[model samples]
Target: MTDSAHIASGHATRPIGGGGGKIFGFPLRGFGLVSSLLLSFASALFTFCVTTMVAIFALLIYRANGHAAVDMAISYRDFGFPASLVVLAIALPLFLTLWIRAKIMG
Candidate 1:
């Protein structure tokens, strides 16, 4: 076989960018594989932060109005209820989204 012919065939067999190939001119494999997980984590963290901020504001307003009991109510069992609410607020939707994503990918 001619050297040119052998070289052409080798080029054809080589993966685009050496296993870093693009799909329809868009690179979405390795990065996309972890993007969903990363997004979910960020979303959950944001939810928790926002919820805590809201709860703190609520307590402050109540405290200013001379009803300190506002803090203790939400702090039931040392903030367990409010914390769990925030977690569920983030987790439920995240779980459903990831589940749907897996099904769609498969």
Candidate 2:
């Protein structure tokens, strides 16, 4: 066979197309590429800061209340599944919204 490695690397002995033209039909525009990269970076930064703040607040609340929080949940008589599910549902949507917004903006 003719040099499998070269074919795999897309740089065979021959130059293939003349003048080293565009690859994959995209013109390799620079401005749009740079703008998208910057947007993605900013979105990631914002998401990370917001999520960190939320986690810190939750930890503070847990530490402050400790047994009180647990006692309150038990008094509600819905400790096991309902409370866990409610927290999961609320937190999941919040996280998902942040992620989706970041992706779209980026």
State the C-alpha lDDT per candidate.
Answer: 0.57, 0.48
Off by over 4 Å in 1: 1-31, 69-106
TM-score for all models, in order of appearance: 0.42, 0.34
Q: Superposing every Cα of model 1 onto the true structure, what RMSD results?
A: 8.8
lDDT of 2 by residue, 1-106 (tens): 4677878878677444323245476322222434544444545555545555555566567769853443433323343334434545554554455445545654
Question: CA shift at 9, candidate 2, in angstroms?
Answer: 51
In TM-score terms, candidate 2 sits at: 0.34
Q: Global lDDT for candidate 1?
A: 0.57
**Model 1 / residue 36 / CA error / Å:** 0.6
Q: Which 10 consecutive residues of model 1 have the lowest summed lDDT? A: 26-35
Model 2 lDDT on a 0 to 1 scale: 0.48
